[model samples]
Target: MTETLLPTATGGEARSAAWTALRRVRGHVALTLLVLTVGTVIGLVGPWLLGRIVDLVIDGRTDELLPVVLGLIGVAIGQAIGQTVGTAMVAHVGQTVIAGVREKAIRQVLRVSEGRIERAGSGDVMSRVSGDVETVNEAVSGVLPTLLDAALTIVLTAVTLAILDWRFALAGLAAVPFQVVATRWYLRNAVPVIRAERVAEGSRAQQLLDSINGANTVRALRLESDHLAKVTAASDKARQLSIRMAAVQRRFFGKLNYGEFVGLALILVVGFYLVRGDLVTIGAASAAALYFHRLFDQFNVVLGTFDTAQSATAAFARLIGVAEMATPDLRDGGETDSRSGRGTDGSVSLRDVRFSYGADQHTVIDGVDLDVQDGEHVAVVGTSGAGKTTLVKLVAGLLPPEQGQIVLGGHDLAAGASGSGHRCVLVSQEVHVFADTVLGNLRLSGEHTSETQARSALDAVGASGWLSTLPDGLDTVLGRGGHSLTPTQSQQLALARLVLADPPIAILDEATADAGSAGAKTLEAAAEKAIAGRTAFIVAHRLTQAARADRVILLEDGRIVESGTHDELVDANGSRYAQLWAAWSTHR
Candidate 1:
């Protein structure tokens, strides 16, 4: 089994990702900042005006009171409007940034090598695409905006307090050392804890997904208890990590509360002294107290957002890590689609090809040389682990041979253009029926194929007859929650796609292995239509399929043990093919 790829990034990589995301929505950021600044300035007027009104009343100046009150009302309205606009702008920037990240992630996923994906299993990729992406989205949409607002409010409040009275400002900021120490400690401890939590969460999700997707296999094999144990272990680990994170937060917040208490106490004590000394008027002292009280709330918000900020930062790092994955250029010799057309004929040639799952593992395919003429239907019959599927994958360019070459027509399969239009198409036993309309699924084969072309392809595969019975015909939705197709019907749909693709070469890896006898006949007929003009490789599970082939190649332990026409092989008294034929006939 292949190692799972974790979604994570180092500090520098995370910073780079953040910068890239911010740069994409610079306009929104600029507008939001401008509006927030205006709002902050306007909001400060309320407290200042309150102080002025108090002074006016003390001095018995009734004439100025009416205008000040009206001015305060106007400032309140402006602040409200500015806040609303700023919030909207912030949300727009957040959404845009996340959208860009999601797009990049998807593109990277598509570019990843199919062999790598198969080895690593679907669980890891699914976790990254669904779970990790969602975590990042929540960070952007919920935590990011709150952190920005809180930070801005703290800075503005600090400035206003200092301008009002230097002594009061000093007193209000007296608890800075405690806050700095606590925050530093929290950040230092919280980062690793949250990182662990994220990894645990991903593992838990992957395990659960695996259990659900392989439920049928688990039940058939009576491995339900084993799967349940694995899922429970993963879930428990995630729960523990979350609890640890919460405990760290509780400790950090306790210190913050203590700091708040100390700061407020110092401000009141200093304000009383300043007023008695006549260094500032009573109204100034009152406003200083109000500012300190308000600043405490804002400061609390700023500090409180740290927990969410840490989680968001970690999630964002994973998103960036995925987006930054290198997409390998698979084209050989720097060839482009324009430089090479489809192979002139579907003839396939393999020369001393070799491959193994790992460096230390025994070779699965070793120096196997074979050739199939254009429009020839060759059947490869072998028991499990004979490297039949592996050989087919090599021919389709889904995996590169470790040694020698495989060519289709005159183009080198290993070095030819990597585009879908230039390669052989493989249809495996487990054909995927996507959750889409029949037409939509057909169009996936060749995006430019028209509806008429799609219908023609379906008709060619003998699927059109059954398809016409669907309530919506080509428009009928299929796969999970939509219309369910039997194994034979799904195989027919896959063959329809193959027709639309129109590749010069095709490989069928036991494509009808899951079908019943009746269904198999229907599917075989469709398969015949699909392979009509193509050079086809059939990894035959049934001897009947081999009988229909132009020639039969019998594989044993990754070597071609026998090769001849079906009758010739059968007549060869002691050949492995003859023995297998005898057994198959007995079973039938």
Candidate 2:
């Protein structure tokens, strides 16, 4: 599986993703533009009315002035109303956009290959889901409005200013050059910096989680200070990058303030001079000055919008990265038929199978041929780092072998031929108990499983001991502050789910290894009983489990070095299986 190639500059890809996200929220775009247009009309009408008031005052007419003033106030109120409605509409759009982004990110993570997830660092995935998605919220809430408001403000201000006086309008246009140049410089540099900073922050979060998860190891090894130093260093790098970006913003703001002051001063001096020289009327001068001030205000809003847009773009890129990393190879309609034993005839075969983690990596499984007949029991034995787990994964169809074919029921595993529930399933050493009831957790794998069926499965796995003790029995919650089951109980719960699923083929890798000998015996007997009429592969650590296998295979360094019935292999005095049996016996 190819993992996410982060830390590689993917600017072009990010831009494309951002545009796609924008397209997804087209409804919001339309509403924002409509509201902005109305708001701008109201805003422009108010200034024009003030200009008319000046015209009236110069004519020495005081009658009906109160009516005109009230008309202006009415226009102001209309502008306020338009802005309020527009803001509310935009806020709704922002929320919808964020929800879409979050869902897409989740789908991406789920679609990615299991091997990629393992190599990509669990911490990074967690960071992307929790932290990277939040960065995009700014784009939704702040960036969109900044964009619409800026565009409408600029358009209306420019038209009003030009109508008042083309010469002063030209001066108003001059500020654009400074604003454009400063903003361009800041954004061009800051986008990459901001993205890098976000990535670094994610790394830091991963490091912190690692420290917490490995707290026992650190304490035993006396490495507390060492781990802390690593976290501190990463955090410091993130802070420095943030400060540097802030400095860029400060410089940009400094230039904007200077440009605004210069534009305002020029308009005031030039307007008064021209009016006094009789080049224009005082009414015209007042109108032009008002237009000039409004232009500056609108221009500032526009620039602010562009800055937010840039930040949003950066956030969009990160979210896209998460999506791309987790893109699934196959799509399932998520339909299920739990009634009539969908994969009951499960039979799997691997021909010349060879597999690796990635390009040019050491092979995890090398050139092995195996067949699992329907309703047969097999045990796989190996030392640490043997490809036993990898082999089982191949049978379960979780990872497609790089060099060979894994066929299930005469059809390639890639075809997903076993129908709704998988033909083969693997239960591993690490068991997860989600925040759900005992029955909820079991029924998650099978849609139509009744409460009685789930309870039966739990009882089959010998998990009824603690489960029956619960207040709600089958309805009892299992995670967090709920039941707080031990590791052995958790493993049994996972097994219970499998029994509920009742896949034709099952692979159990150390399913009961951590549960002690009693748990192991219970699991072995349960497996023999539960898998009575189904194909099963067990990666056995205990010799007793291996001895009971109808057939046994010994793996070493990614290759099958020995295979036969357990008694037959044990009779071969110097064989790999013989040595394993001897070691297991000594330990017992």
Whole-model lDDT, candidate 2?
0.75
Instruction: Find the candidate with the highest lDDT and give its number.
Output: 1
Question: Number of the top candidate by TM-score?
Answer: 1
Clashing pairs in 1: none
**lDDT to native, each model:** 0.81, 0.75
Off by over 4 Å in 2: 1-29, 44-85, 163-168, 265-294, 305-308, 325-328, 331-345, 352-364, 397-403, 410-423, 446-469, 472-475, 500-504, 525-533, 582-588
TM-score of each: 0.85, 0.83
Per residue, candidate 1 scores C-alpha lDDT tens digits across 301-413 of 77777777777777777777778876544333322233123444777899999988767888988888998998999999988999999889888877777898887776775
Question: Which window of ten consecutive residues has the lowest lDDT sum in model 1?
Answer: 331-340
Residue 324 deviation, candidate 1, in Å?
A: 2.5
lDDT of 2 by residue, 273-384 (tens): 8777877677677777787777777676666555556656666666677766533243222232465345556677888999898787898899989887878888998989
